[model samples]
Target: MIRPKWTPVAWLADRMAVLVLGLIAGFLVGLSFAGDGRILPAATTVASTDGPAPSPVPPAPPVAAQGVDGPIPPQVTARMRRGGVLRVGVFGDSFGNGIWDALYRQLPTSDGYEVLKFAKEATGFTRYRTLDLEKRAYEQLARDPVDAVVISFGANDAQAVYDDGHLYPLMGDGWKRVIGQRVDRFVAAARSTGAVVYWVGLPVIRDPQLDADMQAMDGFYEAHMRRLGVPFVDSRPLTLGADGKYTAYLPDSKTGRPVLMRTGDGLHMIGIGYQRLTSGVAADLRRYAARVRQAAGRPAPTPTGEPR
Candidate 1:
């Protein structure tokens, strides 16, 4: 075999060839990276084995559990699962405002209950211009979601009612139907947010005419509550004296003497009166919360942070 003689030109050509090969290798390696120099992971798309994948199964809604108070609201149970407070939103007139404080005091914050005040003074089904109950229910719920709702309305609604270009004069001329529809709408909006609603009826007043009007309103609420299957808290019965009539004073449980329950104006009640007024509701709430915790597989919280 004849061997070629080694020369400067041959050596230079060999070096050039090595340089060209190296440059080509570097160019191929650079192409593997993105323009930003990030190494992209290899990916492959597999063709569908069936006619487009079946729509992803939506999560099942929370099931309602039957409890002593009533059917457990899905929202309430969900909140319990998240270890959140059981929120109670009160909406209506000044009565709602009063009862909110009473309820707040009854249901302690440390016990995992939150009472939100959405009540406004001088606002009712008759007074839509001041505050629209149905609209506000949706808006407020959207802003601060809640699990339970308590609505106290009626005292401020015994006056003139105007709806859809028509004026209703004091509990007459389609007043009951229209106002009942308004109540239904507000409740529907509230229930849409998965909150359980409670309707509070009118209490007995001092004035004869006002008391009669309140009784009539209470009748209306009772009829509607039956139809809607909502709880009707007949405050009149709760506020009645031993004589089975409206009374501003009741025998104090501890003192065994008459205590003034009504305010001087006779339009509202005192703090202790409110406490008594909201006792049933507070008990109902506690029971509902207990049910929620039970359904979520959690135990009741005791003082020592241990389950009861």
Candidate 2:
């Protein structure tokens, strides 16, 4: 058999055919992988020590719910009545500022709510020597009577406490009792002024160890708040992913858009995160106020003044 003349034109034609076939094969392979739910590896940048590191993966969306339960006392209802000046005193560490600021901004203008901020950074129930929150609360209460009190501590409480020159490890036996006593005293002092108490729980932290510590602290708050009949607002479910781990970002509860919720430090919250948290708190407060009105045999007044 005589081979075809190996001319330049023929050689070029063969090469083009091979290239076309290779292209088709590559396209089909990519399509097959796509059908199998496979995707091209995304490019990631290595973080430098000079600046903050970015999140490795996008966080899952937050679940919808608030952490409020039980009935609102009649007295609390009366105090939180609509159209009255709802004197609210907020006390806690830096975390409290996020929620308090959001709450203050979102408070209903018609409700006539007055918020007094008393959040001191790096302060907690355990830091008695450094800052006595219980004493500060008492003094503030005595000076100005508040109708409701909002408290959010525990971020700074996950450390050793010094008592009589002896230091106790955080979450230890002695630490638990001392912190519990302080919390009890603070709650009692707020209640003495006929103010309803709302204790916000710590949210999930970015660091694994810190998240674990926060979870433990939340348990303490839950138990104590339950015993005292104060509303305990657990923020874990809101800030946690479906895997029950801490997430830096969560979807906007209203808009369904992804929003960076936590800060780079992983301990504090950004504005969007704080807004999401306080929105739930405000909603729960409104519900409690409505329940109070109902329990008092006074139906909620219609906005239009028409009988429902």
Top candidate on lDDT is 1
Worst 10 residues of 1 by lDDT: 33-42
Q: After superposition, how far is residue 229 of candidate 1 from its true place, in Å?
A: 0.5
User: Which candidate achieves the best TM-score against the true structure?
Assistant: 1
- Score each candidate by Cα lDDT: 0.67, 0.63
Writing each residue's lDDT as its tens digit, candidate 2 over 1-308 gives: 66567674765575344334434432332222100111110022212343233234332233222123454554555654543455677887777766667666665434445677777666778678877888888888888777667888886666656664455566766567667778878887876666667788877777776578878988877877766666677777778765767777687776777667776566677666766666655666556555555655555544322111
Candidate 2 positional error at 68, Å: 10
What's the TM-score of each model vs. the native?
Answer: 0.73, 0.68
lDDT of 2 at 308: 11
Superposition error at 46 for model 2 (Å): 43
Worst 10 residues of 2 by lDDT: 33-42
Residue lDDT tens for model 1, 1-308:
66578474774574344334433432332232110011111022211242122233332233232224576767668877886568889886767767776787788777878899987765679878777889988998999888888888886776556665555555663576568778778877767767777777766787666688778887777766656657777777667787877788976655867887776545566666666667777777887878878887767765233211
Model 2: lDDT equals: 0.63
